[model samples]
Every structure is written in structure tokens, then in C-alpha cells.
Target: VPKGVILTHHNFISNVRTCVAMFDITSRDTVLSFLPLSHVLERMVMFAYLYAGTTIAFAESIEAVAQNLIEIKPNIMVSVPRVFEKIYARVMDNILNSSSLKRRIFFWAYRVGKKYAARQLQGEKIPASLKLKRQIAHKLVFSKIIERTGGRVRFFISGGAPLAKDIAEFFYAIGLIIYEGYGLTETAPVLAVNRPGALKFGSVGRPIPEVEIKFAPDGEILARGPNVMKGYYKKEAETREAFEGGWFHTGDIGYLDEDGFLVITDRKKDIIVTSGGKNVAPQAIENLLKTSSYISTVVVLGDRRKFLSALVVPNFEKLETLAREKGWHYTERKELINKPETVDLIKSEIDRACTGLASYERVKRIALLDHDFEIEKGEITPTLKVRRTAIENRYRELIDSLYREESSVSSDDFPSEESK
Candidate 1:
């Protein structure tokens, strides 16, 4: 628990150099900085920006980033997935509430843009007719999306969490690519990152030039390189345990795919093993659920239980709008979500979202909370990652009630294998 991660000068310099070469950062580029510099990932990227003599402008606050984007017109930036998630939800919510004709046109352009992007990613030949259609699609839809981001974004570098594949592809269809990366505090915070042109949608990309990686017997990721931390600052015993056979134990569980790209399953300690002995990764389910505009956040909760369930936080702003339109009356958020109609609506949405998942992985029941998991309340980390143990402890009673229903959720609530 006390293994200190001390990054050496060489480690910091090497990571910065790798990023500079990978992105071809130059004096001409301007970066809008928002992530805290206390985070090693932002620290290294900031160093690289200074090394290349690129201009750095700090965002006044997280809420002000949108206005800053327009005012400064940054050429490149680094961010976590939450920013993208918010933008995606807002854009989708507007479309969902728009006129039928506009909705149809937007979706048509979306499909055409996705096809064009797919061809470009694969280096496949594009027929002239398809190219002509793509041009029309951009003129009508994609260009407007880019304008919302100040129309000068080159690309974004995302990390600190897993980015959903569909969200990454959505950006690509609109001509903005989010190149994702992966690492931990012990590895000077960057071990692998996707390159600009050679992008893989869900992967965190290959190892950096100076690092060597391998998987353990239990599938824990292991690394050895100049970039790896020296050792625990004062705890020799913990340091020894972290480094066995000269390889730093990452404590993260993942494996490289056939293409040598890292596919993180989940944290080694976070995988939930059901009572039936089936192993399930909660992050996969949570990512899919978060795509719903009504669901702002979710935590999968079926560890050692007969079936899966969820602790959900709804988008209150959207819910209020719906309540207004429906002429529903409520004085409290909790009372609002407890209505029979609201529960039915959320259940249907969950069923539709989980249609593609296996039976054992789909959420069987859910408890919708009026408020989100807040960092100040100790439910999440400063970086916004959920503190699972704390959240579980805080919501113990709510979670227990989900398992107390007399009957298991009906099959009709979750799609069958054939229906998928």
C-alpha cells in the first residue's frame, strides 16, 4: 500500500520526447490545458509543449473550457473521456427533441460520414459517388459539429480512463479523432498511445519506444523500462513486492490482442465474480449504459450475487424537462424518480441498451438515485474515477433492496440470444 512512485529525470524526459515525436508538436501548435498538472500525464505533456516552444493557455475552469475553446482556438489539447461524453449527450439530446425531418437528415448524414471514415481508416479505395456523398454530408452536418469546437481542433489526446468505442467513432465520423492512451502513475504515466493516422478505435495502442511489457500468469500487466519508477521512496519491502524478477507489477489486469494492442479488461481487483462462478467486467457494461442520455453515471452491482443489478444516477436536467412536458408534479427529485411511469421508462431504456449483451451480463434491476456520485462526498477520485469500495459502502442498503424482489427479472425485460 506504501509503494512510492518516484519518477526520475530520465523517465520524465524520455516520455516527453516520445510524445513530441509521436504528435510532431512544434512551436506553431497551441494547447488548451485543463487537466491538473499534479497528474503525471498532464505534467509530461506540458513539459513536451514547452520543449517544443508551443504556447500553453490554462482554462479558467472546467466549466469555462467551451468558451475558452472559442476564444483561444487551440490547435491541440489533452482531456479525459467525460468532456467528450457530455458533448455527445448534449448533441444527441437536441437531435432527439428536434423535428422529424431534421432528425432524419442528421441520421442520414451520420451514416454516410461513418462509412467515409471507415474507408479512410482502412486505406481502402473510395468510389467517386461515395466521396461526392461525403462532401454533401460534411456540408450539411459534420461541419456544423466541428464549428461547436471552434473549428480549429487538430485532434485530441485522451487518457486517464477507458473511452467508449462508439464515442470514439462518433468523433471520427465528424472529422475529429481522439487518440487514446494508457498508463499509471508508476510508469511516468504514459506507456502506450495511439498514433494519429494509424488509429485503433478501442485499443490504447502499443508500448512506447523505451518500454518492454509482458503479462503475468494471472493476466496482470508487467513493465520494465527506463520509464518505470525507481522504487518505493522509503518502503523497501513494498518496493520489493512490486518488482519481482526485475519487472514492475502494474496491478492492472489486461492483455495484448493479436495485433499487439493493449485491451484492458478491468482493474485486477475490480472484476466481479458472480455466485454462479461467471466472471464479469463491470466497466464494459457501465460504458454502454452511460451512452444513454438519461443516464449520467452507473455502477454495476452483482458481485457474488445470483444476477446483475445497477446503481444509476440520472441526468436531472433532462428528467426535469420530461416532467414538465408530461405535466407531472413533484417537489423532490427522489419523489420524481420513484413514480411508476419513470421506473417503467428507465427499465425499457436499460433493456434496449443491453440487447446486444449476453444474458448474464445484462442488468436485471436498477436503483435510480437523485444525485450523482460526487468527489467531495468521497464517492469518486479527484480525477472523477469512481471509488468503488466507498460507493458500495455508502449505497449498501439501496443495493441490498435490489436483491430482495420476490421474483427474478423476467426474460422479456432482457432480449434473448436469438433476438440479438
Candidate 2:
């Protein structure tokens, strides 16, 4: 439905006030603003910074965030999960491509750091031996990773999408905390956020005092708060639908955990129900795949189908590096992606990432997309979230072929019922 949301000054003010207090933003903090200013999250965050008298630094572009981070030395930054994913991917790429000794050392440090972080997150006291090991891990590996973020970052705020749990843990293990939050433009935009000393890796934290969050029987998160808009512009039907049952309907499906923290699974509409009567979260699978350094973007699709498949955009830079190492001739992107070696590489990555996934949830096959989902192509939103229906429709032929008998991806190829 086409609708312009009407938000008042009071809505912005109340939300901003709560967020500022939660994050403890003050004049001493510097924020690197790179996400589109028109985005509700960025704009609302801008207001919060102004309220806190914080210093705001604008990057020349998203591509320049790394250089800008060094130049600005921002203490606090906010971004969507996409930015963090890229950062994680880049770091992993470098580590994986390094020498055998260096790789082993990095992994050892990572293990130690992760163990330390897990203990800290559980509110358990760290033993003297583990504390010493953590310090060594920071000096040898974590310090170098932190240096890329300007070494002054106190923490980062991730919203707009769910940060991959592994990525969150990796950063936290290295002493860079990502406090993931959950909200929407319709709610002026924040209902819950993880604050210092109350953060959880996967959960979005307890609901803020400013807003109330409940759920429908099916687990669609619902809210009715002063920050929520009264109605949509010129769309009475849509507005009524949004405010069905007297609550602002957030189409996101999630649940409150035992500790009162919010955990968003996936969007209600994005849930894929396969022919096997399995309800799979596409975003969960997509996020899991994106954790691989070789994959840049992926869209999982199996809605009303036999099993899961995906359209994957390979990280060409990493692919080219692999090609160079393998002595495989690769000049053009299309030609390189067509090679059997590349396909096998991606297949292995998918299989590796889908290790713990159930048979119904595992993506059995994927079509290698030469290009990524783009805003100009209407395949992605301004916030870079994939427009699933649009992409599925645009690539209908390719998708259909994946399901055809000739292209019937073997049940033995991946983790499936037949494999066991």
C-alpha cells in the first residue's frame, strides 16, 4: 500500500530522549554518519546527537567510512548490519589469505577472546589465567582489528536489520561491542535497544520505557505508544490495517525471551513455507551465508517449493584472489563465475555454513548471480534490504529452472534427509 506516514515533533522528541538516555550519548562522543540522511534511523539518530550535544562527522561516502573513521576517531557509531557484515567479511578475508602461522595464531586468539567474552556476557568472573590470555589475544589479534576502526570506538550500534550472531560474538570477543537494536519507521522508530551492561548478542534487549511491545498469537510484534503515528497519509484502509485491533501492527515476527529481551526471527511476510510444510526463515539463512567471506549477497527461496535454493552474489575480489592462488585463468567476472572451480568453492561454503541446519531449512542449490541486488533495479530498498518478491519475479526463469527436473539438485549434495 502506498502511504506517507505522518509523524509529529513529539514522536521524534520522545523517542530521541529515550535513546539518548539509554546509550548515554554526550558531548564527548563523536559519531560517523554515513547511512542516508533521509533514512528514518539516521535522521532520528541525528536528532539524538543534537540533543546530546555530540559531535557528528559525515563520511564522504559509505565507501570512505574506513578512512573517515581514522580521520574522525569517532567514539560511537551507528550503522545497519550490512556495513558490519562487510567489515567482518573483509577482516576474515585478510586473515584467511594470510600465512599458516599467522592464521593459526589469529584463530587461537579468537578462541581465547570468544571464551572470555562468553564468560563476561554470562556475568561470570573471569579467572586470572583466562584474563591473562585475553590480554594476550587483544595485543596479538584484537588490537590490530580494533585499529581498523580507529582504536577509539567505545562501541557500535547496529539496527535496520539483525546482526548475525556470530559476527556480534566475534566483535564482542575482540572487545568491540555491537549493541543490536530493533524498531521501525512507523514507531518513530525504536521500541527496544541493547544498552551497556544489559546487552545480549542475539537478542535486541529489553523494551525501552518509552514504548510497549506485545505480540499477536502468531508472534507479530505489536506496539501502541505515543511515538507511533496516528495514521497513514491518504490511506485510510492501510492505516486501519496497521492499527488493527487498536495496536500499531509491526509486520516483523519475533518473540520476547525468558529474560524479557526481544528476539526478532524474521519478517512475517519473508517466512518461507516449503512443500514439506516447513517454515523457514529466509533472513536467518541469508545472514548465515553472508558470514562467509566469499558470499556478498544471497536470497533464499523455497516458498511453496520442494526445498530451499538461493541466488548468490560471490565476492569477486576474494574469488579473483582464489583464482590467482589456484592458477585459474580469470579475467572477466562472468567467465570466472562460470568456471567449475568457482561453483565448487561456493557449494563448499554453503554446505559449511548450513552445517547445523535441518534438512528442510538447508539451501540445497544456488544460482550464481553475476550482479548483486540493487536499488536502481528495484531489487533492494534504500536501506539495502532485498525486496524478495521483486527479485523472485525478475529472476523467475532462473528460479524456475532450479526447480525443474533436469536441475533437480541432488538430496545427497547437501545436508538433507537422504544424506543421513
Candidate 3:
């Protein structure tokens, strides 16, 4: 295995400089730093803040980030999609669980706010009636969401993991911007970032200054830049493989869209080549499923199998609330998760998420689990990334059972769509 990458002083400084320039971070800006300093992404951003003479407030812990955001009133921050996802889920849960009048008002205001923001982005002229409606919407609903962050956040620089488009849109709808980007530890962690004024929902923006990126024959991203690391420590063979033909092999499959923004499909090694020869990217499907408030964690499986299936971990709190409303009875956690109604609830969510996806990309079967993939269980990495091999090994029986049951059929087998 590759032990570690050798990043030099120049690489760090180059990344920090490029990052600060991207955001135009200034001394007036206050950044909330919650991610561990040991991680290259955080470390680079921290140094960039320092380089720009920006104020950095350390968060107490990962769990305390929400509270810290209000107290710090940060002008800019770095975060992964999980943070945004949790916030989105909480907001949706609150609105959905509220009174009928309040729910209607909240949703109505949300639409107006989104329309206003979209129009603003397009530089379209706003009519007086629409302007007044937007102002009312902002005061009635969007203001409360903004107040959660202490109302001063300019933007959130997101990376580490792919940010779901729906989650990004939710933030934008509330007048908050989440700028999603892409990179790995080996690339000093910031190869490309969505700049302040030019943000796209899904695509990671153009490469930073001095970085040259290209796609390989198989669509793997290859790069040659000052930000790239020298080599892996004491692993000559691995280093050679990493830097073959004078380019650093990123091991990520992606392409430059029409506008030259980088769009990551999935990890090269994680691509699932189904028995039918269709190459599917699990991350996209997994990200889509995780958009549902009920879903907490999802692992898509089917490398050499017939079709894709998933192991889903539901947000137990939301599920319990639903169970109460539906009058479902269960004594223990396992009993609750194994109940027929509970399974059907998860099935409905999976089906909704799979609606617009390609037939092969849709999850044919899913096993609902009460527990999340935990790092201590060796099912996930310390960074909270699911270890695919470890998960497959640990849940071998459950996964086999999903495929074994003839009852697990494609989304097409379900009844025609009805209004939600």
C-alpha cells in the first residue's frame, strides 16, 4: 500500500495562495475552522486564512459546529456535504412536522425565495409584484434559516466529498451558497474550487492557476501541477505507478463539461461493471439516495452482479416519528427496522430517489439497517468514508439475502407513480 505522499513547502504555499485568491479572503473575513488540522484540506485552508490575515475561530467539536456557527458569525468556512445534508434534513423535518398553516407558508416562501435568487443570478429584471413577494418571503421564512448561521456567512467552501446537487440547491434557495469543489490529499487537496461569483451546482470549477488537468483513455483524471505531491514515501513502485508518464494519476473518473468545469463521475476503482457490461458509478446513485431525509447512509453494490442493490441506514429519529404516526408497533431497534411497514417506508424512499435514474443505475433491491456504518466497526474509514471491501465482508450474509429474495425487483415492477 502507498504509505504517504511527500508534499513540500512550495506545494503547501502554492495551494494556500491559489485557494485564498479563489475566495478573495481578506483580513475582514472570519473563518470557522472545525475540520481537523491534520487533514491536508483543512491544513491548507487554515494556512490560506493566515496568509490572507483572516480570523480563524476553532470549533469546540464536530457536534458543536452548529452552535459555533451562530456564535462565530463566520464570513467564510470550509465544510463537507454531510454538514449541509444534516441542516437540510433538520429544516425539512421542522417544516414538515409543523402546523398546516406554517407548513404551507414555509413551502410557499421557499419557492418565492428560490425564484428570487435564481432571477438575481440570471440578472433578470424584477417586477414590483414579484419583488414585494420575494421581500415578504425572505422576512417570513428565509430570514429564520439565515439567522441560524448568525446571518453573516458569505459562502461555504465545500470539498472532501461530493456535495449533493439537491442539498446545494436547498442552501441557495435559502440565500446561502455552498460552493462545491474537488480534490484529493495527494493534490494538496485543492485542485479546483467554485469561485465566489461563478458557482455551479454540481460541477467542480476550473482547475486553479498553474494546474494542468487532462482525462486519461479510460476517463481517469490526470494532473501535472505545482500543487501535486512529489512521491509516496519509501514506496518507489507505488510512486512510479502514481506518476506514470509524467502525470499524477488521480484515480478519479471525471470529465470537463462544456463550460470546462470538472464533473466527477466516480472513483475509477469504484466503478461497478455489471454482468450486462454497463459501467455504473455508485457514488452518484448513493448521493441521490442520501438526499432523502429518511436515508442516513447508503452503500450501492453490484460490481460483477446482475444489477445494483443497496444497503441503507435510515435516520432512525425520522423513521420513529413516521412509525408513531402510522401506528406501527415495535419493542426493539431490530424489531422496528425489520417490521414490514418500516421496510416499505424505506422502499418508497428508494423508489422515489431512483425515479429519474437510468434503469441499470436504479437500485433493484435494498436492505434497511437500523445502525449506521461506523468507523469503530471497521465498516468505514477514520475519515468517515465507507470502506467498500470492509462493508461487503461484514454484511456478506445480508447482501446475499437481498439478492437471494425473488421479491426484490426493479423499480419498473412498482405501481405507477401517484401524487405524494
Ranking according to TM-score, highest score first: 2, 1, 3
TM-score for each candidate, following the candidate numbering: 0.94, 0.95, 0.93
Which 10-residue window in model 3 sums to the lowest lDDT?
411-420
lDDT top scorer: 2
lDDT of 2: 0.87
Clashing residue pairs in candidate 2 (N, C-alpha, C atoms within 3 angstroms)? none
Scored against the true structure, residue 362 in model 1 reaches a CA lDDT of 90
Error of 2 at 298 (Å): 0.2
Q: For all the candidates, what are their Cα RMSDs to the real structure?
A: 4.0, 3.4, 3.9
Off by over 4 Å in 3: 125-129, 405-420
lDDT of 1 by residue, 74-98 (tens): 8898998888888899999999899
- What is candidate 2's CA lDDT for residue 56? 92
Q: Which ten residues in a row have the lowest lDDT in candidate 2?
A: 411-420
lDDT score of residue 84 within candidate 3:
86
Query: Which runs of model 1 end up more than 4 angstroms from their true locations?
Result: 1-3, 405-420
How far in Å is the alpha carbon of 164 misplaced in model 2?
Answer: 0.5
Clashing residue pairs in candidate 1 are none
Q: Candidate 2: where is the Cα deviation over 4 Å? A: 406-408, 411-420
Which RMSD does model 2 reach against the true structure? 3.4
